[model samples]
Target: MLRPAASSSSGRRRRSARSRHAPPQRSAVVPSGAPRPPQRLPAAADADGADARPAALSVRPPGPCSPRWAGSGRGYANEPRRARPSQRLPPQGGRGPRGWQRACARACARAPCLGQHQPFAACRGRKRKKERERVFSLPAGGRARWLVLPGSEMAGLTAMEKKLAEYKCNTNEAIQLKLVRFPEDLEDDNTTFNPEYSHQVFGDDEVAFGYKGLKILLYYIAGNLSTLFRIEYTSKVNEKFDCVEADDVESKIREIIPPGFCTNTDDFVSLLEKEVNFKPFGMLLHTYSVHNEEAGEDITYQIYKADMTCPGFREYHERLQTFLMWFIETASFIDVDDERWNYFLVFEKYNKDGATLFATVGYMTVYNYYVYPDKTRPRVSQMLILPPFQGEGHGAQLLETVHRYYMSSPTVLDITAEDPSENYIKLRDFVLVKLCQDMLCFSPGNLMQGFSQEMVMEAQQKLKINKQHTRRVYEILRLRATDMGDAEQSRSYRLDVKRRLIGPYKKKQRELAKMRRCLRPEELTNQLNQIDLNMQHEQLEESFQQLVSDYRRVLERLAQA
Candidate 1:
């Protein structure tokens, strides 16, 4: 117990002292006809020397401590007398006298005796000791629980999970498709060459969420009863779908497609050799081969533009987009009937033992938006190069061919892409920079003067480049021309870019000043509505640093080109 031991002599003396200071109690019973002693009251002197009874006797009730008072008296006559408990001892621990320190230490080290009357005091010391030293130390000779540090287990778990059968797909064959709706849409190769456009479209966006695009394609295919599709090429499949069967075409087509796609060439080629030509759609655009000098063999390939007018194009397109749901993260099917949509496809062509063999590679889609009176703006919407064929320069060659096809059109404006990805941006930058280098307007002397109205006008007229893109190109080219070792040249370039970033902040400051004049005095000093000058400076510096870093990368690429 925290209190002193009852067996000790000092404890007895302390208990005796406590008992002497306690209030006396009355007995619950009294003798019936007990004679009461008459109490004499003290007299007090009042005003004018008049004698009066003591205030205590006049106003107070009978005291419980008085020996003459009986239990029948008015004061607490019905109340019962009870024994009082002993004073509680102060809790030990923390900074204290040396004797208390030694006692508390001993109490903490000893285990509790649960059978004791005061369980709280006996167990509380152990709890307090644990709280003071809560380190996770293991006991000696015990079976050690493996304490894995945070983050190491996940990598091992992922590797083990990959070995399970459920982690892999059922088959390795897939059909490659390129869906487009319009002719002019195939102008920009970036739509297909840029890696950013290789996205899966989930049906969450404005136009595609409810399968509207696929519905239109299905409707078109259903109306054309006599049309047949020719599956000119395939990869990783043994079956050949040459002339497709019209009746129950959707189910048959579904059966032909493997559970997964774009990975295994051997399986893909084997699957394509199977004959399932009951219902087919699409036709071959072109077939050719490239001579690989290193291998001294001619590698044949085919390019196809999907004919929307064909009978089964709609069902084929709908099936093709199913691949998007599996492969691309943000791929959504396009509306087949939209006159503005256009499709371009690429396939691998080879001679297997003197027999012509074709396999699917990749494809792209574009949308042609009408410009104001007499022109058209072709935008590349989506592009993909099959995983197996990626890094083989097929994307660049396909994009260039598309660009050349539209370059001859008098009504066609410069090509553009929608929400180009970072990889696409890099590809676009490389292509545009290479094209602009040959033009007189982007010469070294012209770039060193910074961006100008003349340069913008020239790029717009000759290269069909927009003003915003022109400004960016100028910055990139200017950085290329600049000699960073020269202090004056580097400082000039830094200040030039920083000035452009500060333009919006300055304009906003003007608007704020006008607003402050119209607002009431009470609203003017509100911290939330006001802009801090220090914060503005910090933002400008951060923006400039980022811009300079990006420009340096562009400049490095330009030098290599």
Candidate 2:
């Protein structure tokens, strides 16, 4: 018995030694129809196991061991093994790839015996390092918790940005205007034009928000001036999308156009058919002709002075004045019920279809304010030449005709303009200089003698020109007569105008002297600091140069006239 036990022990030891040094066996292919033996997944606890994977990945859901992982020692007996990367299922709940990554991070954080296992510890370390890198890479004012948006939320933001980009439009380019003479004019693309400015109608930004491919079309008949307004767009932002409201284009146009305008194209065309019967309103004040270089013929034009009393004139005046809002920068309609308000309209007389037709060229409004005694000051309130007729010398003819009409009135004191535009001021200067050039006081010989009381008296008595205008005319005529190449003559002309320009500075100085007597010492110091005499001198020199430049332009135009 001792010999048999010794031999068995010795054989057991020899067998153990042989197993330690033996090479691993290869897996054999099984027959197609034969049943294979069950395969077991390697335990996650074994560091040196051939098939070991991370604990977080191994414990992921949809496996039998996943649900029991919180209470288990190793794994469930019937647990399904993890699928290969090529056969892995997509993440649930439509979370996408981001969700899968987040789920793995959470698994690593909640893993059992995380510190005791090498795979879990490595996963946790990698996750922490990635988190630290992400947090540190953010902008200075950003918080890690809210700075990074989820994949779904990020996609939503991208869609919103695209929507905003798709809807924005410039109001100036989007709005088109046309003057339709016949039915064919509407179909002609040549008739369509855009307003130069839209900030007056829209906001300062001039952006028509919340619309895609927007167009606001306004049409007016060439003769009767009947209107057709419409809006078009591919898409508009609505309450369903939580976007800003589109600009109220119709309301803005309504504020300028009168209520009697036709909104339909058919109705407007019908109105246009009746334009042949539309004649000049009130009494015919003056008639003139302009040579149209394009037409190679003289175009006849007539001016009419009308009040609210003429038949159909009130409605016509309303239609005429609507152009003021478009062309004039600071225009407002006057109360025509007052007898003092006078409307002067210019119309082009032409023969169309064997009948005489009158097209509106332009119009002006005058408010006769009562001066003391028996005189009336006729102030030019608003003047507008229709855009189609502008740059055609219609404005010059209209202003001169109006001046001649006003010149005939003995009760009129002088002509003035209410907040005249720079263009209007230039127009007035040209007209006044033209009229004054024919007078003895503004003769070339008399102009060299400098501005005089005789010039003022004659201008006020005959032309009803104010003292201010008389001074301007005298300067223009003087500039015309001046031999600018001669330094002595040019120096004399400049000194005369500069003397007038220096009056304001002298007046300011007198006021400052009075302030020194009245104001406190500290107040006087502040006031003194505000007035830089050197700057004033520089500004005065600039003003003189500008005035001289303007005078030279007037001379050039006068030479042409």
- Which model scores highest in TM-score? 2
Task: List runs of model 2 lying over 4 Å from the truth.
Answer: 1-162, 519-523
Which candidate number has the best lDDT?
2
User: lDDT scores for all predictions?
Assistant: 0.45, 0.65
Candidates in order, TM-scores: namely 0.48, 0.70
Q: Whole-model lDDT for model 1 versus the true structure?
A: 0.45
Report the Cα lDDT for residue 165, model 1: 15
User: Which tens-of-lDDT digit does each residue in 517-539 have in candidate 1?
Assistant: 78677776673256888889999
**Lowest lDDT block of 10, candidate 2:** 135-144
lDDT per residue for candidate 2 within 1-561, as digits (tens), equals: 000112366656766777553421211111222232332222222221111112322333222111111111223212322222321222211132232233322222222222222111112222222212110111111101111222333344444435545676888789877877678988898878777666777756676666888988788777667788888899986644332235467888888788877777888888889887787788998888888998999999988898888898988787777666556666667888889988888888887688888888888888999999999999998888888788777788888988899899999999999998888888899899989888998898998988899999999989989999999999988887889899999899989998999999999999999999999999999999999999999999899899888877877877876
